[model samples]
Target: MTARHAGYIVTLAEDIREDDADHIMTALRMVSGVISVQPVTANLDMAIARQQVHGEVRGKVLQLLKELQ
Candidate 1:
């Protein structure tokens, strides 16, 4: 199958602390094809991670979120 590269966004759950969000962002950056990780200030508990993935990357992003918990 051909590799399809696209942006994947990881959205954190609300009520997460700032420190925890920061830590999550750090871990997200370690994922493959991750271009950037930015915190969403509008929601303290929420953050968005931008990544370029080949094929499907939602699973990976979900795993990352699970790891944060």
Candidate 2:
């Protein structure tokens, strides 16, 4: 018998600089138990960088919650 757990996906509203993202990831990883922050695609038209922040945090989305709050 085995058990599997579902993960979370967080999307940041603002286009975050790579350095800032790295800092946030470090802070959250300590408690949030994150798996990884995936590719960030910059949209020239919208001037927004979309990134995939995946993990198993029980509460709010890490990237967006951190940046928004």
Candidate 3:
């Protein structure tokens, strides 16, 4: 016999406004099998920082490639 445990973390494609976060969390709590719902704004900030760093790195690589050509 085996027991299974699983969890999921979801990220939205677009940023949710502060005013709407509570509403969103409330809706998620209403869903079945939802043990808990907590908002983590830090992850969103980290994601944005990561994207900015990625863009900077991409631009630098492209510039380097042009210089090498």
Candidate 4:
């Protein structure tokens, strides 16, 4: 099995022209607790992102995304 890390997954529009996965990853790093980012993609232009974070931060990254929504 793949090693586990504390983070969240993000999805974007398949046809979104400006699908900047790197930018999204950068934003994740700007968050208070995010430490790193991993970009994994699949067919149909879909992406699977994993934002590595500190254990003490718990769900801080998730909380930030919730606020954006």
Lowest summed-lDDT stretch of 10 residues in model 2? 49-58
Per-candidate TM-score against the hidden true structure: 0.45, 0.41, 0.53, 0.38
Cα TM-score of candidate 3: 0.53
Query: What is the C-alpha RMSD, rounded to one decimal, of candidate 3?
Result: 4.8
Candidate 2 residues 1-69, lDDT tens each?
Answer: 897766666667667877667777776577565666574555764442222222334244676688897
Q: For each candidate in the order shown, give its overall lDDT on alpha carbons.
A: 0.68, 0.60, 0.83, 0.61
Predicted model with the maximum lDDT: 3
| 1 or 3, greater by TM-score | 3
Evaluated against the true structure, the overall lDDT of model 2 is: 0.60
lDDT string for model 1 (1-69, tens) is 999978776655445777768778888899998979877565323223233332248778788999999
Q: Rank the candidates by lDDT, best first.
A: 3, 1, 4, 2
Better of 1 and 4 by lDDT: 1
Report lDDT (Cα) of residue 60, candidate 3.
100
lDDT of 3 by residue, 1-69 (tens): 897657668777667887878888888888888989877675777888879989999999999999999
**lDDT (C-alpha) at residue 29 in model 4:** 88
Candidate 2 ranges with C-alpha deviation above 4 Å: 1-5, 44-69
lDDT per residue (tens digit) for residues 1-69 in model 4: 899868877665443334656677678889987877766546443322222334336688778889999
TM-score, cand. 4 vs. native? 0.38
Q: List the residue pairs that clash in candidate 4.
A: none
